[model samples]
Target: MQLVVARIGRAHGIKGEVTVEVRTDEPELRLAPGAVLATDPAAAGPLTVASGRVHSGRLLLRFDGVQDRTAAEALRNILLIADVDPDELPEGEDEYYDHQLVDLDVVTVDGVEVGRITEISHLPYQDLFVVERPDGTEVLVPFVERIVTEIDLDEQRAVIDPPPGLIDDRAEIASSRASREEA
Candidate 1:
């Protein structure tokens, strides 16, 4: 299987280095030197990583054939893909691949069916599961260990222990809290 690991951003300097919007949980392994990555447009690469570094908190990479800013600039917005084994799992027990979480059914601990995970939104600090409700509405559920209690692949389900107001309707949650406080 092939997984998208990063997107080529703007050319950094005149040194063939380009900024990357990293997509993988293990950038060190996926975007390392000598790593041959497939490109989105298919013409821009099969680029081999010559070198990589972190500059000003951003990931910068230089490809083997891309030796100048103009060449690197031409590859902008192209996605870099890495060939991965389907069975390959992350080193951490708590870690899960984005593909594994997407499409899982979501429910509360008490078994109230909430929705189905339609996408996994990967942000810099944290990841979120985009759940689509039966009514076609969507909610962004933070994929935190505290809130996302369990993931059962066999059942194709994810159990979440949502905080008060998280799963509840906005007006209902506020009104209920207000009434309780008044009493």
Candidate 2:
């Protein structure tokens, strides 16, 4: 599978260089001279990395054939993706990629299947798992260690307590807040 590693922001200087917002933690490991990277799915050819270096907390990349400000401006908002195997990812125990957790089945401690995870939102304090139920209701579960007991990526399942009425209470609170803001 192809994973997004960075996004081309804008032309940094007049030296045919563009600033890249690095998404991967191991930017040095991923960026290299002559490395192949894809921008979009329909992108004709992989962009060859002529050179790359970190400057001002952002990755500065110079692509082959892209010279001058006009050429670099054309690459703005292009996402850089690399072919990566999911199994090759390094994850510690109880850690998983946000993409992997999405679409996984969720169950309770008693083995009762609740719903399927549709999305994962990484908040400042904790991660939130958005589970979609068969009845079309979405339950936003907090990824707290106390609430979420276990996560089995291999089995594509997660065991969570979620607290009684926690989902409904949060939904009501959100609705009320929205109404107040609209007033």
Candidate 3:
């Protein structure tokens, strides 16, 4: 499996050090020094990681042979992909690879069909599962233990216990309010 580990950002200094927007959970293993990564454009890499450092809370990397700011800047926005084993799993029981969750059916605790997992949005604080409903609408479900009650990989589904307005239309609230006013 080819997993995207990071996206190259701007050149940090006059050297060939570029900041990266890390995408994977295992950056230390995937983006470490001496690691070789493939690029999205297919021509920008196979780049080897010459060195890496943390600068102002961000990760900066110096790729072998990329010796200048212009060279590093040129690699900006390029995605770094690493070849991973299909059977390889993350080291945590509750953790999962993005690929494992994508395409899984989403359902309510009562077995109401909601949608299918379409994408995983990795935010700084939390992750979200982008689900595509049968009607073509999309919902963003926070990947939290409280909301996502269960992930049954064997059943290929995710069971959620969404708050009242989280899944249902908010217009239901408005309708009830209007009815009470009429009464």
TM-scores for every candidate against the unseen true structure:
0.84, 0.61, 0.85
Superposed on all Cα atoms, model 3 deviates from the true structure by an RMSD in Å of 2.5
Enumerate residue pairs that collide in model 3. Answer: none
Sort every candidate by TM-score, greatest first. 3, 1, 2
lDDT of each: 0.90, 0.79, 0.92
> Compared with the true structure, what per-residue lDDT tens digits does model 1 show for residues 1-183?
888899999999998999999887788999999999999989888999999999988999999989899998999999999998988887888888877777999999999999999977778788889999888888899999999999998899999999986778666778989999999
Winner by TM-score between candidate 3 and candidate 2: 3
Q: Candidate 3, residues 39-132: lDDT per residue as tens digits? A: 9998999999999988887999999999999999999999999999989989899999888999999999999999999988877789899999
Q: Where does the lowest 10-residue lDDT sum fall in candidate 2? A: 22-31
Model 2 residue 178 CA deviation (Å) reads 13
Give candidate 3 misplaced runs (Cα > 4 Å).
169-183
The numbered model that scores best in lDDT is: 3
Model 3: lDDT equals 0.92
Weakest 10 consecutive residues of candidate 3 by summed lDDT = 164-173
Stretches off by above 4 angstroms in model 2 are 91-99, 105-149, 158-170, 174-183
